[model samples]
Target: MANIIILGAGIGGMSAAYEIRDAIGKEHAITVVGDGPVFNFTPSNPWLAVGWRKPDEIRLNVTEPLESRNIRFVPTRANKVVAEANRLDLVDGSSLNYDYLVITTGPRLAFERVPGSGPEGFTQSVCTGPHAEKAWLSYEEFLKKPGPVVVGALQGASCFGPAYEFAMILDTDLRRRKLRDRVPMTFVTSEPYIGHMGLGGIGDSKGLLESEMRQRHIKWISNARVTSVEQGKINAEQLDEQSAVLKTHELPFSYSMFIPPFAGVDAVQGIEGLTNPGGFILIDEHQCNPTFPNIFAAGVCVAIPPVEVTPVPTGAPKTGLMIESMVTAIANNLRDVLAGKPMKARATWNAMCLADMGDSGFAFIALPQIPPRNVTKAMSGKWVHLAKVAYEKYFLRKMRKGKADPIYETYVMKAFGIDRLKLEENID
Candidate 1:
């Protein structure tokens, strides 16, 4: 029987396990290794931080489902991976060998890159459950005594959605509490433009996002590198091409949330022939490591170069749908390999994003993550917010039941509302 070892139990890994479980069945052995027992729903982190979701509401114990599927569950952090030996060593002093390995450990937030960027005592983040808890308490304190607030992403940070979401959510919350006028809000980012979003403005997103921020009365500074952060001030550098002009700005704030730059998990770092300089796993379009054919990777852990280094340095953001596509491609390829058939065409992942804007949301679709394809025109409306809510509910139900279906994929594609998407040729 073939033995499969999957690393990390996050969204991409869990979805791949579920898909592979049905495809390979008892004929093959599957094992899942995770650093912890709880599976965090990252998208809901912001809501939890804002007092909309509780810790228990977003946490799911993954042991039961894997047990039912007869998949081995090892609740231990992976410390080292010997790609040549096809083995993984765990932090708990155990090791396992595998016929095939899948890595989906997700991104590592480089908190130490920026001074005082952590939650040791100052600032807060909604990137994880513990961080969200701290953020909730910090936000409560801020509510009690409103003051200046700064929210944005750090240098080389690719995940822009959460930063934008948190800013809007905070604005909505402050306005609801009649404290919007009192809070001196500033939106800061490393992007060159207000709506760059790391993907160079999907479609009309530039105009729409800029207009929205203007309406919200949030001050912004682009192409700004955060040098250091103090209790009530920020040290930044106004960067032009190949040079920087140092500038320090003091703005006392009761609360601040800054998205840190993302890198590959330490386990994947320094591994020979596996990752890029940034430590993200390097995979072909099929999600298979070109250096190690038996290894595959997905999610934020994989290296996808920036669409353009442009006006400001920014990396591409891999959303849920994009990760799902990568996982699907890897699963299908594995199935083909087991069946002794040539692998199918490499996956051409497209990005579909819906950014919720409180009362309404903006939706955008990029046919192929890399340009020169049929990138759809971005659309927005109140209905988009309703759809996003429905999607969250649908996703939670599916995960709770340990089910994987194509319905979610089709639904996401339909949400793009582009006619060309109906054609199969447009996908590959």
Candidate 2:
């Protein structure tokens, strides 16, 4: 029987465990190691930060369901991976030997990359459920007395969607409270344009996002490198890449929420022939590390090159659909290996993103998740917001009931109108 150890229990990790176990059957043993037992739906963090959802409503314990599957659950941090030995050492001094290891530990939040980005007691983040809870409390108190607010992504940061969602959510909330005029909102980012969004503005997103910001009376600053942040101001550098000049500016704010640059989990970082310079796991288009054939990576921890370079670089965010495709690829590869059959790697897919703007939301789909695509579209509607809420409820229910259906694949193909492409890409 194959002994597989999966790291992290987030969306990608959990999905990996489910897919692998179903394909390989009960003879194979699967164990999942994660930092915590709670699976936090990170996409809803922005709503949590804005006090739209309670803390308990956002978290679901993963132990009981995983236990029902006879999958061992190790609630501890993965300290290191001994790739040569095919083993993992835990932070609690425990260890495990494995025949195959799937490193799904998602991206690490590199808050320290920027000075004063986070010390827990000072600056706040809505990246995680617990972090969002803290930010929600702070927001409630901050709203009692108005002040300037700052929100944006930092240099080398890839996840810019949440920053935009949170900014708009807060703006809509403040407007409802009649404090929009009292609070000065400034969006400070490292991207070159308003709607760059790491994919070079799908279709006319640049015009659409900028126009929306103007309509909402939201101010923005781009091509900014936030050198450091103080109690009331952020020191940034404006660069003219062609001229190579750096101009400094000080922007004041009463509250700030900045998305940190991401790096690979410590367990896989710096391992020979395993990780990139930025500490993200190095995987080919097939989602497998070429040097370690038995190892695979998915989600934010994997390295993907930026589509384009602006004044400051912008990298694409790997959305849920893309991650699902990666998971399918990895599972199929492993299945073939165990069955003594040839492996097939699937092609990289595009992305569909739904960003909630409080009472309403925006829907976007890009063929290549970059410019010059066959199809790039974005639309704003209240249904998008309602759909997101319904999705979260349905996903959590499925997890609680211990049914990991491949229904998400159908949902994705339907949204993109590419269901037939799956058959075209099949290599049976």
For model 1, the superposed segments whose C-alpha errors exceed 4 Å read 241-243, 246-248, 406-424
Q: In candidate 2, what are the lDDT values of residues 115-164, reduced to their tens digit?
A: 88863534678788888988888898898888999899988889888988
Give a tens-digit lDDT track for model 1, residues 268-329.
88987899988999998688898999999988898998988754568899887788778778
* Model 2: residues with Cα > 4 Å off, grouped in runs: 119-121, 241-243, 406-428
- Using lDDT as the measure, the top candidate is 2
- How high is the lDDT of residue 112 in model 1? 86
Q: How high is the CA lDDT of each candidate model? A: 0.80, 0.81
lDDT assessment of candidate 1: 0.80
